[model samples]
Target: MALDQLDGELEDQEESSEELYEQHSFKIDGGQEPLRIDKFLVARIEYATRNKVQKAIDAGRVLVNGKTTQSNYKIKPADEIIVYSHYEKRGERIEPQPLPLQIEYEDADLLIINKPAGLVVHPGSGNPDGTLVNGVAWYLQQQNPEISEETLPRFGLVHRIDKNTSGLMVMAKTDQAVTSLAKQFFNHTVYRRYIALVWGDPAEDEGTIIAHIGRHKRFRKLYDAYPEGEYGKDAITHYTVLERFGYVALIECRLETGRTHQIRVHMQHIGHPLFNDDFYGGDRIVKGTVYTKYKQFIENCFAICPRHALHAKSLGFLHPTSGQQMRFDSELPADMDQLIEKWRRYVKAKGDLIVESK
Candidate 1:
């Protein structure tokens, strides 16, 4: 996706930190007739038109068999077509609200925030206002009353984390910062590490999860990990076991690519859904004994952290103007911290019981 024009008007659309341009891939059927590449794509892609497809082709964002192609090029049987589209956003401005925000780091070009759980990043659907973006707008307005929405890129938000996932996030204060930071995120150069409490103990202490993640076929709101790359975008997560209880574990996950719900979906794919993650089937007791006491203990832990046990623990990237490395780290929020401590105590007491019984 091109970053040539950062000052252009943008819409109030929802996008992840890692998704700068929407990508679509198609494999031509064996019996399909030859058709112009632009026309071929327009028919298949939703809300796409000949002009948009041709513009994408002219920008060399369309690839056939991994190579750039002309808009009029005839599609062939069994040919692979990939298209990258960077759509400009335009709509009503986000209402600046005086919401409380935890500023971790700030400079002339960017701002780092320790986002708390239960705070929505961007307004959408049920969330019309009172989001992180709205807070940032208010903050920016406080800093410069005359600042216009067009001057700030994504309203200073370069990336986002889930509302339930607390931790560090960076926002670009200037257009140049947005351009540079967006490139870093798209290139996968930015560093992101998450702390997660998963339901089961992984076989390996450390490993990498390579899968294509996309929206679930049946559950449009939820994402699924496709190991065969059958659908969705490429996603990778490197994980290391931090602590182990018999039934669950604390793990650190480093993202190589940021797809929507990448860590949550990938962990679930490997058979270890995040503890208490209602969307991915972790809301119930996935591990441990089925005894009443054990079940009650697990329920207590769930009550400690009502949401999914995931936190964006750290973030790193290059400064937009200085070309210097800038990294930030955050502590686990109270809920997650308390949950881990409870697990620790539970494991230790169980160990003591075993020792005494023997």
Candidate 2:
């Protein structure tokens, strides 16, 4: 809810290149007694001091039952609450250095990269150096020796994946590329797909999740699905199961509308969470047996991945300069690829433990 602290500890990149993001929702119990929303929230929300709640209210980011409410408004039972802030802040200055990059495709107007897991896309407060941005800037400097991070109008990233999520990213290299590609993202014409290993299989082999995602009221960094489209922007995700391991499922997600953490939130809303996604309560085992050996195996899996099992496996969009359609695919990073293999072996050894795959 608070931008200062969110689902993850990432600093804001350049302000002009950044967009405000929301990821945190709450619902009051029917029998709850009246209490000042801010006071009530402070007591209920973890790490949410009274001062922070008051400020969110003052900023008009606090909502009650789908309407903006002040800090002092007495909350009623069944009243849904939500808070929001810019996903990150422009907290620090950015400079360039010769950081490494895994280039996939590059042209005069844009660059496609196979970003590794744990790589921050840009310079932010917690990650002030050695980011993909820094690396790209350095690469650009080698060619022109005149362009620098400060001189660049924007970071050139049309969109971003999370720091822990691995996959393909296409960043713009020129002003024309920025405007054209950004428009594609805004128009929801950019085709994006993600691969994830989640805790459980879905009820359907394929389905769409359409919900208004907003910030979690209690957990400031997490999100909740508002089915009524109340608190946040509309988001749509379609998913199809590719494989199932009794306790987990490997699925593909197609984004029709891109929002922060869209796939993660939708999967969670459907009772499945991405494996090892610590922010959304996926670090612990959500499925599987209670046996010590199974528990140890899960813990081992966590150790292997250490981060959420998600990857931006594919992207397709029109070329900004040529207006020609472009598409790219990437192999899963080592951690996720190996994690799936581990599950595959476990399922095979367990025989009947196998869940039917779609």
Candidate 3:
């Protein structure tokens, strides 16, 4: 029933974009007590806060019984409700700049790009220029000489990969493209796989991590994973080992639910953080011995990657217009390949080094 509701709301909205993709519907049970709609919605919604619900209400994105409702409207039993949330394009104009872009695929509606490490996906805070969007905007402006930079649409990305995670990304070039891609993401049908070099080999060649991922209560920037699903949104990460180097392993990760930092947090929960992931304490020598040589070897490996050893290797989805499925694959980035090579040489030179218990 929720899936059906998702489809209806998506089709009805014309202001859809990558940032504004969340839509869900719910019905109050027969035994439910009357409560303010904003509070009720926040409790039922995943990753939602009170402020967000109130903001949505103010924006008239929340409907009760097919009419826009205020934050204080009391919900009753069997009452139908729909909540829509997404970041509206801001009024502030984004200045376009010409920058180098690696275009993997381009058509009338979208562009697929092979993003590199250390490049931020969108502009915010300290990074306001040299972003992928600015480059794309410039390219679009170049193609349409009649269209001025000021008239270019604000943004086009349907999803995002982390700044340090090099990989392929698709961005919409038209309003219809954005809506179709958003629906696929909301329904969890968009296929994406990642390659990661982590601190240790898994006992099984392949496995899955089903856990709830939410922001840490104490650490503002970190996430704490709950296996019992008591808190946070549901997240599942399936991984398979591709290679092992005594202290580290190359693995493939496929995501079933795309929560923020899902792979990094899930791997850390399982004692195998991504190699060189500075945020989750993987930057240290997590699985290697204390020998000086071993420490130096790991340090060199860190230098090679310099960031979390993660790459988005593949993407698949149904075409927005043609309704045909498309999948794209990419070779490992040079930095990750170099890091893997270093590990291979180290493991070969020194036989399997057992990792002792903490």
lDDT of all predictions, in order shown? 0.80, 0.76, 0.76
| Candidate 1 residue-wise lDDT, 115-228, digit = tens | 999998876667779999899999998998876565564476667788898999998887667656766786789999999999987888899999998778777678788899
Model 3 misplacement above 4 A: 1-20, 24-85, 88-92, 145-154, 353-358
Candidate 2 per-residue lDDT, tens place, 64-112, comes to: 8767788789988888887653333333445667877889999998899
lDDT of 3 by residue, 261-345 (tens): 7889999999999999998989998885779987888888888889999999999999888988989999999999999888777
| Residue 216 shift from truth in candidate 1, angstroms | 0.5
Estimate the lDDT of model 2. Answer: 0.76
* Candidate 2 ranges with C-alpha deviation above 4 Å: 1-92, 149-151, 353-358
Root-mean-square deviation (CA) per prediction: 7.5, 12.2, 8.7
lDDT over C-alpha atoms for residue 30 of model 1: 93
Backbone clash total, candidate 1? 4
The count of residue-pair clashes in candidate 3 stands at 1
- Winner by lDDT: 1
Clashing pairs in 1: 10-89, 10-90, 11-89, 11-90
Q: What does the lDDT read for residue 110 in candidate 2?
A: 87
